[model samples]
Target: MENQTKVTEFILVGFPSHPGSQLLLSVLSSTMYAVTVIGNACMIFIIRTDSKLHTPMYFFLENLSILDICYSSVITPKAALTFSLGKRIISYNDCASQMFFFSLFGTTEAFFLAVMAYDRFTAVCNPLLYKIIMNKRLCVFMVVGSYLSGCINCTIQTGFTFSLSFCGSKEINHFFCDVPAVMYTSCSDTLVNEIVMLALCGSIIVGTALVVFISYGYIIITIVRMPSAESRLKAFSTCSSHMLSVCLFFGTVFFMYAQPGATSSPNKSKAISILYTIVIPMLNPFIYTLRNKEVKESLKKKFKKKGVFFVPLLRMRMTTVSN
Candidate 1:
């Protein structure tokens, strides 16, 4: 026990050296990390300052941006700097902290995405009662519930994960300390840990996914029943951005954690993990901004109010002609 505890750090494996892959990973990781922070931060700023965006939809979006800022900050900073360090080492406790926050924010984002979907349903299918149903108190409650759920999941999984003896290879076969990657280093039995992780993570992913799908199912039905073509188009447009965000995030996350205990190549795992951990955060601002007329309008209003070069902005702003 003393010797195991004395082992304080683990080596993180970078990509195999193949024609500048390491440099590429570093550059790509750094770029994405920067974009994720700036983009999400700007989104939060936009949402906060825009009174027009204080509604439930933008409220949920603000929370989602906050989550994006969080989970990515925990993981991306280290991953971005991996190649710069000669040793590529991380302390044992730090690894556990990283895993804990990553899981917490990731799980919270999952639940919150489901909540966003339901918000959309209420907006589209029950517009008259939307405000009354999705009141401020309820929004706060759902947001708190998602965070509390994530806290519980993180505490349980992180505790179970680090409890196992990790006296084997201190080398983790990935750029960061992920659950599956860290589990690979444990010398003691991880079967139960793996089972717990799978059960909890799978439940969160699958269960929240069902909520999103079911909500969208009703949304689709409602849209279909609408008489006018323009109304149907507008209604579908309202949900499109959320659906895209959902597909990108849930697909990558499901691929990563849904099959815990299953053996796969470290490189394969790392490649897929990048999509959610790195790529999604960077894309989210664009996803919610470019096609979103309201966000663009808000940006226009903001820029116009600040008197920050409005002519070029006016030219670019017309591109998002849809809702």
Candidate 2:
């Protein structure tokens, strides 16, 4: 205890160092944040308004988009503000809260993505059972399960991190209060926490990755075995976007968490984190909308209707004014 350093808060040094970087970082991050919200919102709205997207695939996609929005919101804006103000101080309690939510959302995403893979598998491999297998109740339950897993993971990770005493210098090496980064600052023994992290977080990442791989593996086989060329092509197309999203989201995740601390680079982690948090979400809507003919047609119909409805109203107003 004598040598223990009491830390009230921790400083988060975010992004590369540069003069007036705060202003630049703030503007850039703010734009990204805005786009994330709008993009995800549009996705949710399109999925909702467009009856054609009323399938299990789109249902899960809507939830995934929403999660990405929140996942980005939890850390990006705060980090941006810190960069903008050139202040990186985060209180102990706030830091723990951030870590908790971040872990929760992230863990939930892993499970959700796994669920999506399974959905794709059923849609491809068991076309007849797709309806029964992915019913409304089942979809709702899956979403709930993802949230529950996230909550439990958050509780465990946050509880573990907070239990340790932080009687030391509070300068965190990373932009966020990631579990490993926080653990490094603790004066108390963190072996248990680290082990839990490796076991729980690692398992979630690896387990989800395994599920996705297996599902896609089976799907590819099923697609190839199909007698009709058209059916095979359509099936592959349907799942291609989901597969791409999965690879991007979880690939960086596994790469970041799977590595040992000795070899992990702060710069690498930050860059990969940016990919998942900023770039991936921005890319999803484009992937789905562009690849899926139904989504494109739906958008066209929605806009066309708006244009037709508004044009008549404008004409009526002009005629009444002239009379």
> Could you tell me which residue pairs clash in candidate 2?
5-167, 5-168
Q: Which residue runs of candidate 1 sit more than 4 Å off their true CA positions?
A: 306-323
What lDDT score is found at residue 294 in candidate 1? 87
Give each model's whole-structure lDDT: 0.87, 0.84
Clashing pairs in 1: none
In terms of lDDT, the best-performing candidate is 1
Candidate 1 structure quality by residue, lDDT tens digits, 172-289: 8888888888887788878887788888889999999999999999999999999999999888877899999999999988888877544255778888888898899899999999
Q: Candidate 2's residue-wise lDDT over 1-323, tens digit each?
A: 34332555788877757857668878877788888888888889999998889999999999988998888888888878787877788987789889988888889989998999999999899989999989999999999999999999899989888788877667777778887777776778887877787778788889988999999999999999999999988888888988898899888887766555612366677767778767777777888888777788888998999999999999999999999
TM-score of each: 0.92, 0.91
lDDT for predicted candidate 2 compared with the true structure:
0.84
